[model samples]
Target: MLSRTPKMLLQTPGARRGFHSIMSSLVPMVLEQSPRGERVFDIYSRLLKERIVFVHGPVNDDMASLVTAQLLFLESENPDKDVYMYINSPGGIVSSGLAIYDTMQYIQPKVNTLCMGQAASMGSLLLAGGAPGCRSALPNARIMIHQPSGGAQGMASDIAIQAEEIIKLRTRLNGLYASHTGKPLKVIEQAMDRDLFMDPREAQEFGIVDSIIANRKAPQSSGKQ
Candidate 1:
């Protein structure tokens, strides 16, 4: 029985001002309530012996941190089990996104990404971070990659620092794209610069995605297997 009512205690004046503080304390519980929690609870309730974990939702620092912790836990407890990642997000902060991607890569889990809606920008990068043979996207869903952009403010030196940061970000972005798609770095950079949005079919054609989940067919070998 999940509580649908917003907790009024979280809405009080003092609570409002310290909302972040209080939320930080409750973040663990909220994150567990996300897809991961449901999967764990289901396994326990059904008394199943197999391992299955679902990591899904909007990309944010807090959520990434939570998922990272869970991934670490899984690696320690059940290192051989395949971890399913269901991604549906418009993406978030660059650092947060990269942190999640790095964490996933560190675990080296067999991650199957079932995109129910959209996996755009950083979300796409995270999906690509999965083990080579385990990455995937649903047929009706979309995956988009583009140049990273952010806002900055400060003095002349500060502006120069921000410009440098953007250049580095773009370089990293291009590297990720080239590694995943096996396309020429310049070609991937051009597509990202042009803000390409790819459907599952187009992604497969471009070698950005390994296989299409259409017609209820099983995933094809990604050449890594």
Candidate 2:
């Protein structure tokens, strides 16, 4: 019995070329690993061709750079297609998260952000920042939002400047959340005063997610949602 060829291999010529490029990049890794690496490489290539991006770790400079590049590349490849971003992060540096968020907004393609586990702090902001009506969370996913946190250790004058900057970041982030969720700025600010956590349903109510994904009877046939 012959194994079935991947759908990507059967799609448009463009997809085949994209898949080939993905495989080419993974060749070095495949050469250095066991057979399992091949399997991993295959899955990763499929995901890339499917236009799925993952954010499964902390939001840092490296993650920002890679994700930004992927978003731009996908947009260049097909500006009309929707991009899927699956996020499961505890959140990290504000600057790094902003870089990704800015790119998401800058791209022509609609970004469908799916929360798999927890989207907290800056992570929650990114979740809310997805294209309107495209943000979603799994049934058991949790979401959180809070004011940006930072520490300052220096002379009184320098510490004061740092404190001012932190306040500015908090204000900017609060404004963004309010704009995305259509909530009052004061309401968003109050919610962010502490670590406010919510499940999928609550996140929907809070406007962090437009919907909670339900079980599908069949595999997803399109990237619209």
Candidate 3:
């Protein structure tokens, strides 16, 4: 029975902290052995304990896939618990970011998004899309939103089709932002016309984040363990 259970599972606050440190130490050695070691040593094992998911670096299909899986798995483990998402991304593929965003909403647990460094473009969308009243950013974090840009080179007709798709996507994004921020769709479109950048205070004012985390600690999760 014990063998059937997860070996890296850490219960209790102290255990989570202690094992997190231990796993951090083990990650380098594990990486030396296998390139895929991060999946086992760094992300999944640590995630199971803290129920925290990090969306670091540029958002892409692979990153989106992993994050979606983690969110679903965490929800499957405990639907009532709040999941914390730490995002520090420069942004990337639109569809990829939307995949993660959709999954965030599909999951039952409330997701609390905290911008660590920057959440620009699609990253900004994900931040704004977090559970209302739960989105936040570090004091120095930057947030940005802008119209989607795409490239099409096959033919003029194809380019026009791509342009149309981009317009539709931009509209969808604007609607989502307006829904989350309580701002009007036209306002969102205007703000997204150019790269609108914001610091924590500005982001909060712009409705990209609910609060600025100035306490230097992770924000509290709303759900009981």
Candidate 4:
């Protein structure tokens, strides 16, 4: 379902040492389960009811559709509230992540992304789209950024067209990262030329993340979104 039941929401277990780590492991599975079991206190159920969206697997067309729909729904329902997105994907198709990233940018509300596990490749591109100061990752989470690639074969003309398209795609990706991180396009391009694996600390230092999530407590933030 694109929308969650309003009554099905549950509060997240507040900060305990290693709470994020624990949730990081369990949430992806828990959130997938239906409301058959105890639904009231179900963390996953609650997350859906709130403004939380989970990206637990690959970023493909299906994944992209779900996230974009949820973000659009959340923004329409409450334009002032923030949208909390947790990503734990190995990454997938470039255009899939781009759709979600574009949706996040188009929304009036601030979209916050949490790297709970492996946010690599196209996943990092999605993470980079979060509104300023809203991008964060768990202390032990891993993040990566890299150039996009694809293959094509047919006539020589087809191969040439594919090559030109890939080049354009790389340039677009470079511009996206540079705009988000305030880094030079050359710097972002160099980092992406090879797979760049980073922990939360390095990701923050590299401008991929703005904060290291210490806790989940939120007290009605507003304005500067």
Candidate 5:
């Protein structure tokens, strides 16, 4: 499991300005190595081989951008291995979600998603992008799906453009559901219209996931041969 150093800062653009100032004011810390003694290592050094990256928080453009970058880095570093994504998001911007989905699909890694909390709206779509043998949620986790939503300003033509974009987003989302559930497109569309929400068991029953992995163990190989 790969571990990364935690860096905390308020995520919103307005809030980040204060964090930037605070960081700039701090003097950097420096530590010197002992040059003459036997070498010593810390826990992080001993645990470098097994790493699990944690990407927890709201789904926004900044988060999406960072996730995409990390996915690219992981793909480059480990081209043949599966990348586990533990998602617990209440969902956010549709476009941001699409950006993440596109990156995940393009990387083509076997993505195993563990939905520990909630995977709703756009988050559900991202979960659906996982590879065929991907794992699913813990017992209490939930997954939800619905039509795309957006806000608009300005003229009537702008509204029309936004509407068209929403339609396209819905079509893309429906396609994902259809592929994952092996359901007809029309049926998936109807389900999306219903604003479907399912717990782990229900989701698994409907073919939304392979199984409910409550123990959080490594996903077993499906042995498709």
Candidate 6:
């Protein structure tokens, strides 16, 4: 077994990348020696390391990397357990959020997402991407989803091309939100034009949030591989 380390507390944006990078680098090195049989799992449970992921600030590349690293580590260290991701982010960087979304979809462990405060824009997308009936929010949490925006500099043609790409992304996202929420793309499209915001109950009705959390409860997985 590798040497046990203290809990990595990622309280600041600056600390996230540093912490998960350590886990990312350490996994391959230690996996061979990591116990697979029924051994004490506290080593992985410290700080709820393998079972929980937090998105508490703006979404960005570092946040994406952190979430990726955490998922990768948990996949390697505890593939059978459930992961609880709590999001309280204001959203940022569309590509970063998409990266995190892809990882959440690709990872082996089932992910249950809870919006503890607010999830807007990309954050709302992330919240809706949770595994099946696993999407939820605090009773007072808020959610917002809107068309993505982008900017480009340089040649006029290049700017027009970038604008077209942004429009494409908006279309893609509208369909994605529709798929998850069971709403039609046109409905989502109109709402994005005005920056739709919803409380927990409204979000559930909108199909973005599956349940409004009234207390702490561990969600049951769908048991699908």
- Regarding lDDT, does 2 or 3 come out ahead? 2
- Across 35-131, the per-residue lDDT of candidate 5 in tens digits comes to 6755544432222223233334456667677678777777887877777777776677666677887887888567766777877776777676777
Better of 4 and 5 by TM-score: 4
Query: Which sections of candidate 1 miss by over 4 Å?
Result: 1-57, 215-217, 220-225
Residues 105-139, candidate 6, lDDT per residue (tens digit)?
Answer: 89888889999888988889999999878899887
Single out the weakest 10-residue window by summed lDDT for candidate 2. 6-15
Error of 2 at 55 (Å): 1.0
Clashing pairs in 5: 1-50, 1-51, 1-52, 2-51, 2-52
- State TM-scores per candidate: 0.73, 0.78, 0.78, 0.77, 0.73, 0.75
**What ranges in model 4 sit over 4 Å off?**
1-45, 217-225
Instruction: Give every collision pair in model 4.
Output: 9-46, 10-46
Lowest lDDT 10-residue stretch of candidate 4: 6-15
Q: How far is candidate 3 from the true structure (C-alpha RMSD, Å)?
A: 13.0
Q: Rate residue 127 of model 2 by lDDT.
A: 92
The TM-score that candidate 3 achieves is 0.78
Candidate 3, residue 95: CA error in Å? Answer: 0.4
Q: Which stretches of candidate 2 lie over 4 Å from their true place?
A: 1-42, 217-225
Give candidate 1's total backbone clashes. Answer: 0
The worst-scoring run of ten residues by lDDT in candidate 6 lies at 6-15
The local lDDT score (0 to 100) that residue 23 gets in candidate 6 is 45
Tens-digit lDDT track of model 1 for 26-114: 33221134554453333321221333334344455566676677677767767777776667666666776787778777884566556
User: lDDT for each of the candidates?
Assistant: 0.63, 0.77, 0.76, 0.75, 0.65, 0.74
